[model samples]
Target: MRPNVRLELIRKLMQQHNNPSFMKKIIVAILFVLLIVGGGVAYYLYNKGPLDVISSHAVEISAVNLYNSFLSDSAAAGKKYAGKVLEVSGLTEDVSVNQNQETIILLRTSVEGAHINCTLEDKTKVNANKGLIHIKGICSGIGDGDPDLGLPADVYLTRCFVINK
Candidate 1:
Protein backbone atom coordinates (compact mmCIF):
# COMPACT_ATOMS: atom_id res chain seq x y z
CA MET A 1 0.00 0.00 0.00
CA ARG A 2 2.73 2.44 1.07
CA PRO A 3 5.68 3.51 -1.22
CA ASN A 4 8.24 2.01 1.19
CA VAL A 5 6.34 -1.29 1.32
CA ARG A 6 6.11 -1.48 -2.51
CA LEU A 7 9.82 -0.63 -2.88
CA GLU A 8 10.73 -3.37 -0.37
CA LEU A 9 8.58 -5.88 -2.25
CA ILE A 10 10.25 -4.98 -5.62
CA ARG A 11 13.73 -5.28 -4.05
CA LYS A 12 12.92 -8.76 -2.70
CA LEU A 13 11.65 -9.88 -6.12
CA MET A 14 14.80 -8.55 -7.86
CA GLN A 15 17.02 -10.30 -5.29
CA GLN A 16 15.24 -13.62 -5.86
CA HIS A 17 15.67 -13.23 -9.66
CA ASN A 18 19.37 -12.36 -9.23
CA ASN A 19 20.00 -15.56 -7.22
CA PRO A 20 22.00 -18.11 -9.34
CA SER A 21 20.02 -21.12 -8.07
CA PHE A 22 16.70 -19.42 -8.78
CA MET A 23 17.81 -18.46 -12.31
CA LYS A 24 19.15 -21.96 -12.94
CA LYS A 25 15.84 -23.54 -11.91
CA ILE A 26 13.91 -21.22 -14.25
CA ILE A 27 16.27 -21.95 -17.16
CA VAL A 28 16.15 -25.72 -16.53
CA ALA A 29 12.34 -25.73 -16.37
CA ILE A 30 12.08 -23.80 -19.66
CA LEU A 31 14.58 -26.10 -21.34
CA PHE A 32 12.85 -29.23 -20.09
CA VAL A 33 9.48 -28.08 -21.44
CA LEU A 34 11.08 -27.20 -24.81
CA LEU A 35 12.80 -30.60 -25.03
CA ILE A 36 9.53 -32.42 -24.43
CA VAL A 37 7.76 -30.40 -27.16
CA GLY A 38 10.60 -30.95 -29.63
CA GLY A 39 10.65 -34.71 -29.02
CA GLY A 40 6.87 -35.01 -29.51
CA VAL A 41 7.08 -33.13 -32.82
CA ALA A 42 9.95 -35.30 -34.02
CA TYR A 43 8.08 -38.48 -33.14
CA TYR A 44 4.96 -37.38 -35.00
CA LEU A 45 6.94 -36.54 -38.12
CA TYR A 46 8.92 -39.78 -38.00
CA ASN A 47 5.77 -41.91 -37.80
CA LYS A 48 4.10 -40.10 -40.73
CA GLY A 49 4.14 -41.92 -44.09
CA PRO A 50 5.22 -40.47 -47.44
CA LEU A 51 2.72 -38.86 -49.83
CA ASP A 52 0.69 -41.06 -52.19
CA VAL A 53 1.47 -39.61 -55.61
CA ILE A 54 -0.33 -42.31 -57.56
CA SER A 55 -3.86 -41.30 -56.55
CA SER A 56 -3.18 -37.56 -56.42
CA HIS A 57 -4.35 -35.13 -59.12
CA ALA A 58 -1.55 -33.68 -61.24
CA VAL A 59 -1.02 -31.04 -63.94
CA GLU A 60 -0.25 -32.62 -67.30
CA ILE A 61 2.46 -31.08 -69.50
CA SER A 62 5.06 -32.19 -71.99
CA ALA A 63 8.67 -32.18 -70.84
CA VAL A 64 9.82 -29.89 -73.64
CA ASN A 65 7.04 -27.38 -72.94
CA LEU A 66 7.76 -27.37 -69.24
CA TYR A 67 11.45 -26.72 -69.88
CA ASN A 68 10.58 -23.96 -72.32
CA SER A 69 8.29 -22.31 -69.78
CA PHE A 70 11.08 -22.27 -67.22
CA LEU A 71 13.54 -20.99 -69.77
CA SER A 72 11.24 -18.16 -70.88
CA ASP A 73 10.37 -16.95 -67.35
CA SER A 74 11.69 -18.94 -64.43
CA ALA A 75 10.09 -16.73 -61.79
CA ALA A 76 6.58 -17.19 -63.18
CA ALA A 77 7.11 -20.87 -63.95
CA GLY A 78 8.47 -21.53 -60.47
CA LYS A 79 5.38 -20.00 -58.90
CA LYS A 80 3.09 -22.05 -61.16
CA TYR A 81 4.92 -25.41 -61.04
CA ALA A 82 7.01 -25.57 -57.88
CA GLY A 83 5.60 -27.70 -55.05
CA LYS A 84 2.73 -28.87 -57.32
CA VAL A 85 2.15 -32.28 -58.85
CA LEU A 86 2.96 -32.63 -62.56
CA GLU A 87 2.45 -35.42 -65.10
CA VAL A 88 5.23 -34.87 -67.62
CA SER A 89 5.30 -36.78 -70.94
CA GLY A 90 8.40 -36.89 -73.14
CA LEU A 91 10.99 -39.09 -74.72
CA THR A 92 13.30 -40.69 -72.19
CA GLU A 93 16.81 -39.34 -72.54
CA ASP A 94 18.30 -41.49 -69.82
CA VAL A 95 17.43 -43.45 -66.71
CA SER A 96 19.84 -44.37 -63.96
CA VAL A 97 20.14 -44.80 -60.23
CA ASN A 98 21.70 -42.13 -58.11
CA GLN A 99 24.19 -42.65 -55.25
CA ASN A 100 21.19 -42.93 -52.93
CA GLN A 101 19.92 -45.78 -55.14
CA GLU A 102 16.89 -43.78 -56.20
CA THR A 103 15.81 -44.12 -59.85
CA ILE A 104 16.44 -40.91 -61.80
CA ILE A 105 14.78 -40.45 -65.20
CA LEU A 106 15.70 -37.70 -67.62
CA LEU A 107 12.93 -36.62 -70.02
CA ARG A 108 14.39 -35.08 -73.17
CA THR A 109 13.70 -31.58 -74.47
CA SER A 110 14.54 -30.01 -77.89
CA VAL A 111 17.32 -27.96 -76.26
CA GLU A 112 20.59 -29.84 -75.99
CA GLY A 113 21.57 -31.09 -72.52
CA ALA A 114 18.32 -29.77 -71.00
CA HIS A 115 15.92 -32.32 -69.58
CA ILE A 116 13.21 -32.91 -67.00
CA ASN A 117 14.89 -34.76 -64.15
CA CYS A 118 12.41 -37.03 -62.38
CA THR A 119 13.26 -39.02 -59.28
CA LEU A 120 11.13 -42.14 -59.21
CA GLU A 121 9.55 -43.55 -56.07
CA ASP A 122 9.57 -47.19 -57.18
CA LYS A 123 12.87 -48.18 -58.78
CA THR A 124 11.69 -51.54 -60.14
CA LYS A 125 8.63 -50.17 -61.97
CA VAL A 126 10.18 -48.14 -64.80
CA ASN A 127 12.63 -49.41 -67.45
CA ALA A 128 15.44 -47.25 -68.77
CA ASN A 129 14.97 -48.42 -72.39
CA LYS A 130 11.39 -47.15 -72.58
CA GLY A 131 11.17 -44.77 -75.51
CA LEU A 132 8.31 -42.52 -74.36
CA ILE A 133 6.70 -42.31 -70.93
CA HIS A 134 4.48 -40.20 -68.73
CA ILE A 135 5.75 -39.66 -65.21
CA LYS A 136 3.86 -38.00 -62.41
CA GLY A 137 5.61 -36.23 -59.55
CA ILE A 138 5.94 -33.06 -57.55
CA CYS A 139 7.82 -30.23 -59.24
CA SER A 140 10.96 -29.18 -57.39
CA GLY A 141 11.69 -26.30 -59.75
CA ILE A 142 14.54 -25.65 -62.21
CA GLY A 143 18.26 -26.04 -61.69
CA ASP A 144 20.22 -23.11 -63.16
CA GLY A 145 22.96 -24.36 -65.44
CA ASP A 146 26.34 -22.77 -66.10
CA PRO A 147 26.56 -21.14 -69.55
CA ASP A 148 30.37 -21.19 -69.62
CA LEU A 149 30.39 -24.93 -68.79
CA GLY A 150 27.83 -25.66 -71.53
CA LEU A 151 25.39 -27.18 -69.06
CA PRO A 152 21.69 -26.75 -69.88
CA ALA A 153 19.06 -25.80 -67.29
CA ASP A 154 16.95 -28.68 -65.97
CA VAL A 155 13.50 -28.93 -64.38
CA TYR A 156 13.47 -31.19 -61.34
CA LEU A 157 10.67 -33.45 -60.14
CA THR A 158 10.74 -35.57 -56.96
CA ARG A 159 8.80 -38.59 -55.63
CA CYS A 160 7.88 -39.51 -59.21
CA PHE A 161 5.99 -42.59 -60.43
CA VAL A 162 5.38 -43.93 -63.93
CA ILE A 163 1.90 -42.98 -65.16
CA ASN A 164 0.29 -45.93 -66.87
CA LYS A 165 -2.09 -44.78 -69.60
Candidate 2:
Protein backbone atom coordinates (compact mmCIF):
# COMPACT_ATOMS: atom_id res chain seq x y z
CA MET A 1 0.00 0.00 0.00
CA ARG A 2 0.87 3.74 0.04
CA PRO A 3 3.24 5.19 2.77
CA ASN A 4 0.42 7.35 4.21
CA VAL A 5 -1.89 4.32 4.48
CA ARG A 6 0.82 2.25 6.25
CA LEU A 7 1.59 5.10 8.69
CA GLU A 8 -2.10 5.45 9.57
CA LEU A 9 -2.40 1.73 10.19
CA ILE A 10 0.62 1.77 12.44
CA ARG A 11 -0.77 4.74 14.40
CA LYS A 12 -4.07 2.97 14.99
CA LEU A 13 -2.29 -0.18 16.15
CA MET A 14 -0.14 1.85 18.56
CA GLN A 15 -3.20 3.62 19.98
CA GLN A 16 -4.92 0.30 20.61
CA HIS A 17 -1.78 -1.20 22.13
CA ASN A 18 -1.21 1.82 24.46
CA ASN A 19 -4.79 2.04 25.70
CA PRO A 20 -4.70 2.99 29.41
CA SER A 21 -7.73 0.93 30.42
CA PHE A 22 -6.47 -2.20 28.69
CA MET A 23 -2.97 -1.84 30.19
CA LYS A 24 -4.42 -1.33 33.66
CA LYS A 25 -6.58 -4.43 33.35
CA ILE A 26 -3.60 -6.53 32.13
CA ILE A 27 -1.37 -5.33 34.99
CA VAL A 28 -4.11 -6.00 37.56
CA ALA A 29 -4.68 -9.49 36.24
CA ILE A 30 -0.99 -10.33 36.31
CA LEU A 31 -0.64 -8.98 39.87
CA PHE A 32 -3.68 -10.94 41.05
CA VAL A 33 -2.33 -14.18 39.62
CA LEU A 34 1.10 -13.56 41.13
CA LEU A 35 -0.43 -12.89 44.56
CA ILE A 36 -2.49 -16.05 44.52
CA VAL A 37 0.46 -18.23 43.41
CA GLY A 38 2.86 -16.64 45.88
CA GLY A 39 0.40 -17.09 48.76
CA GLY A 40 -0.18 -20.74 47.87
CA VAL A 41 3.55 -21.53 47.73
CA ALA A 42 4.19 -19.74 51.01
CA TYR A 43 1.41 -21.61 52.77
CA TYR A 44 2.59 -24.95 51.44
CA LEU A 45 6.20 -24.39 52.47
CA TYR A 46 5.10 -23.20 55.92
CA ASN A 47 2.90 -26.22 56.59
CA LYS A 48 5.40 -28.79 55.28
CA GLY A 49 8.50 -29.45 57.36
CA PRO A 50 12.00 -29.88 55.95
CA LEU A 51 12.08 -33.68 56.23
CA ASP A 52 8.74 -33.99 54.47
CA VAL A 53 10.31 -32.49 51.35
CA ILE A 54 12.49 -35.57 50.86
CA SER A 55 11.74 -37.93 48.00
CA SER A 56 9.26 -40.75 48.73
CA HIS A 57 11.16 -43.26 46.57
CA ALA A 58 13.99 -43.78 49.05
CA VAL A 59 17.04 -46.02 48.74
CA GLU A 60 16.84 -48.84 51.28
CA ILE A 61 20.19 -49.98 52.69
CA SER A 62 21.79 -51.15 55.89
CA ALA A 63 23.26 -48.65 58.30
CA VAL A 64 26.69 -50.21 57.93
CA ASN A 65 26.58 -49.99 54.15
CA LEU A 66 25.45 -46.40 54.31
CA TYR A 67 28.33 -45.58 56.65
CA ASN A 68 30.82 -47.35 54.44
CA SER A 69 29.63 -45.53 51.34
CA PHE A 70 30.11 -42.18 53.03
CA LEU A 71 33.47 -43.17 54.43
CA SER A 72 34.64 -44.28 51.01
CA ASP A 73 33.50 -41.12 49.23
CA SER A 74 31.39 -38.54 51.01
CA ALA A 75 30.57 -36.41 47.97
CA ALA A 76 29.36 -39.36 45.93
CA ALA A 77 27.29 -40.73 48.81
CA GLY A 78 25.72 -37.35 49.44
CA LYS A 79 24.72 -37.06 45.82
CA LYS A 80 23.13 -40.51 45.92
CA TYR A 81 21.39 -40.44 49.32
CA ALA A 82 20.95 -36.81 50.31
CA GLY A 83 17.35 -35.58 50.37
CA LYS A 84 16.13 -39.17 50.15
CA VAL A 85 14.42 -41.43 52.66
CA LEU A 86 16.40 -44.44 53.83
CA GLU A 87 15.32 -47.65 55.54
CA VAL A 88 18.27 -48.65 57.68
CA SER A 89 18.51 -51.71 59.93
CA GLY A 90 21.20 -52.15 62.56
CA LEU A 91 21.72 -52.61 66.27
CA THR A 92 20.58 -49.76 68.46
CA GLU A 93 23.65 -48.48 70.24
CA ASP A 94 22.12 -45.60 72.17
CA VAL A 95 18.82 -43.78 72.46
CA SER A 96 18.63 -40.26 73.78
CA VAL A 97 16.52 -37.12 73.57
CA ASN A 98 17.80 -33.78 72.40
CA GLN A 99 17.08 -30.37 73.90
CA ASN A 100 14.08 -29.97 71.63
CA GLN A 101 12.67 -33.27 72.96
CA GLU A 102 13.47 -35.01 69.68
CA THR A 103 14.43 -38.67 69.97
CA ILE A 104 17.91 -39.46 68.57
CA ILE A 105 18.87 -43.10 68.06
CA LEU A 106 22.42 -44.14 67.44
CA LEU A 107 22.58 -47.25 65.27
CA ARG A 108 25.80 -49.19 65.57
CA THR A 109 27.72 -50.05 62.43
CA SER A 110 30.90 -52.02 61.59
CA VAL A 111 33.03 -49.10 62.71
CA GLU A 112 33.63 -49.14 66.45
CA GLY A 113 31.79 -46.42 68.40
CA ALA A 114 30.69 -44.83 65.11
CA HIS A 115 26.92 -44.92 64.78
CA ILE A 116 24.28 -43.53 62.45
CA ASN A 117 22.56 -40.69 64.30
CA CYS A 118 18.88 -40.96 63.48
CA THR A 119 16.59 -38.27 64.80
CA LEU A 120 13.12 -39.79 65.08
CA GLU A 121 10.06 -37.83 64.10
CA ASP A 122 7.90 -38.60 67.10
CA LYS A 123 9.50 -37.63 70.38
CA THR A 124 7.11 -39.59 72.62
CA LYS A 125 6.64 -42.65 70.43
CA VAL A 126 10.19 -44.03 70.45
CA ASN A 127 10.79 -46.82 73.01
CA ALA A 128 14.09 -48.09 71.75
CA ASN A 129 15.50 -51.32 73.18
CA LYS A 130 19.11 -52.45 72.96
CA GLY A 131 18.68 -54.64 69.91
CA LEU A 132 18.30 -54.68 66.16
CA ILE A 133 15.85 -52.04 64.89
CA HIS A 134 14.64 -51.09 61.46
CA ILE A 135 14.29 -47.36 60.91
CA LYS A 136 13.02 -45.20 58.07
CA GLY A 137 14.44 -41.72 57.89
CA ILE A 138 15.69 -38.96 55.56
CA CYS A 139 19.44 -39.18 55.20
CA SER A 140 20.86 -35.69 55.53
CA GLY A 141 24.60 -36.32 55.40
CA ILE A 142 27.61 -37.72 57.22
CA GLY A 143 28.30 -36.70 60.77
CA ASP A 144 31.75 -35.92 62.19
CA GLY A 145 33.75 -38.86 63.47
CA ASP A 146 34.98 -39.31 67.00
CA PRO A 147 38.29 -37.45 67.01
CA ASP A 148 39.72 -38.86 70.21
CA LEU A 149 38.87 -42.51 69.57
CA GLY A 150 39.76 -42.40 65.82
CA LEU A 151 36.38 -43.80 64.91
CA PRO A 152 34.93 -43.43 61.42
CA ALA A 153 32.30 -40.84 60.59
CA ASP A 154 28.57 -41.49 61.11
CA VAL A 155 25.66 -40.97 58.72
CA TYR A 156 23.05 -38.46 59.85
CA LEU A 157 19.39 -39.30 59.32
CA THR A 158 16.49 -37.04 60.24
CA ARG A 159 12.74 -37.52 60.74
CA CYS A 160 13.31 -41.16 61.59
CA PHE A 161 10.46 -43.56 62.40
CA VAL A 162 10.87 -47.07 63.76
CA ILE A 163 9.88 -49.57 61.12
CA ASN A 164 10.51 -52.67 63.21
CA LYS A 165 11.68 -53.23 66.78
Best prediction by lDDT: 1
Error of 1 at 105 (Å): 0.7
Following a full C-alpha superposition, what root-mean-square deviation does model 1 have from the true structure? 9.1
lDDT per residue as tens, model 1, 1-165: 999999999999899998999999999999999999999999999998877788888999999999999989999999999999999999999988899899999999979889999998876746778588999999999998999989988899999988778
Give lDDT per model, in order.
Answer: 0.92, 0.84
Model 2 lDDT-worst window of ten: 49-58
How many pairs of residues collide in each model? 0, 0
Per-residue accuracy of model 2 over 15-121 as CA lDDT, tens digit each = 87789987888899999999999999999989986655234656779888999888889999999998788888888899988999898999988888788999988
TM-score of 1: 0.69
CA-only RMSD, every prediction: 9.1, 7.3
